[model samples]
Target: MASNRPAPQAPFAPDASEPFAYGAPRAEDGVWEEWNPTEESLPAVRGRHRVAKQRGGGLARSSTVLGVGVIAAVGAGGMASANTGKPPVSIALPDLPSVDSLIDGHHHTETPAASLSGVATATATAVGDSTADAGEALRSRIMAQAERQQSKADSRATAAAVAKADQQAAEAAAKAAKEASVKAAAAKEKAEADAEKKAEQARLAALAKQYTLPTSSYTITSTFGQAGSMWSSGYHTGLDFAAPTGTLIKAIHSGTITEAGWAGAYGYRTILTLDDGTELWFCHQSSISVSAGQKVSTGEVIGRVGATGNVTGPHLHLEVHPGGQPTGIDPGAWLRGKGLTP
Candidate 1:
């Protein structure tokens, strides 16, 4: 039979470096702003694919020529059968040759020409050549695409690693700054607390030296505001210390003597005035050492206890007044308030 068939299709060719520009703003300094797509502005592609088709001129022409050769041989066989009285013989053909070797200058040949078997073999060989060429081209393109994809994946992984390292360095710097600030504030607070504690201790020490007891050997025989038959006003308004004659009397605090002379019914009197106008009077003195307007220190000898004025025995009479007003209070309690023992 005469063979007639169309040529096989070729493989598709893909463009490797096609430029796809997304929608982004153009800047004046040759910089493009990134475009971020929202759900409303995003584009979708459905069932999109790159289709390729191949065409062949050589395979189609060769197949047609081989078919004519086969028809001529078969017609010659039928004419010979009528001329001779011999019986007609049938034959089988082998497989076709590879298309790659044929294209590269390697042609194939079979023996026993001018027979139906040889003609059929040549026709099948032409069709097989076209199909094999198409398949080889497709395989080459697929292998090239796989290599490009692998290279892109490696580049993306390297970029991600560099970005992560930069982020970690920034975080470490921020944490160090925060710790330094906290340490500085704590140091300042500690300095202020130490200074305040030192000031309080100094104030207490100064108060202890400013006050002291008048005399440690004397006893209180009469207190302020005493009510007895010994007074014409029915109440004693001054404190009295009863001791032996010529007992040494000392100044209670630092002050100036404002009056040191004889007074009626009180014998020799010595009046001392403090800085704030409080006056202390010591009476019934056998002798007075401080003169008027003389400054005296604490524990200094001021007078000697005696039995002068309206008294039954030798004793020292003391009186305290604020601004010279006779508002008598317990002298023992007053001395204690100044951190002194009476």
Candidate 2:
């Protein structure tokens, strides 16, 4: 039954719980314009993302909220219930939409349904493959660099060893050469000394072979400086050999006969000139076998002994004059120096 007891009074202003906003009223000239809001003439209040209208335009907002709720449910694998009085509802999930449709800002009547997980999995696999390849390349470069450094180190070591070996070898060779040179010098000096000694011995042996005695056999008579009345000088001035009247008198050494003739108070005198200009005088000879300026060898007969000079008996007088001087050294000592005994 309808009760007509006085219907509830209609409120003059809009409901307070409803979303309401006001637009700035337009002004004509300087005065505030009169506001007249009809059914189709109300101004819309707007922000960057939305416009709020009055009366019939408010229903469009409710429908847009319903559409957004339907999209959210599909993204969450929609759960809704068909049973009345149930707290939760059950609904089938729709596939995810394409990325272009989600960001286009222009609405589309239909969006392609695809598996997002498949695309994500493929992209992740590709990223992993690229990362692994980059890592391997970096590792290869490091290994190559390390190998190069090691090779350089090895080369340096080998070169150092080779240089050391070469230096040692050179030193050894130099040492060997020095020793050989020293030995050669020593050998040369010793050989020279031996040759000099042998030459000296050979010279001495030849010199000994060239000397001879004045006479083969004879006896000393009156010696030199013996005091007596021998005519001219009161003392004997020469050595005397007491021999037979015809005893052979040979040359004592090789020389040239300088004077071989009769001299005053002497029968036949012979003066032999030696190599050093010393004179050997043979006086009181019975006969002379050599002439002046004649060469005579050692042991060659040059005269015969006789009592021709001032002598006490038949003997040969002999005098030695050095450098043709009138004085002489002892003949016995001179003959001994020549490796002979008189």
What candidate 2 gets wrong by more than 4 Å, as runs, is 1-208
User: Model 2: how far is 180 from its true place, Å?
Assistant: 40
329 Cα displacement, candidate 2 (Å): 2.8
lDDT of 2 by residue, 96-125 (tens): 443334443234334222323333334434
Candidate 1: Cα lDDT at 266:
85
- The TM-score obtained by model 1 is 0.39
Model 2 residue pairs with clashes:
80-89, 80-90, 80-91, 81-89, 81-90
Clashing pairs in 1: 10-54
TM-score of each: 0.39, 0.39
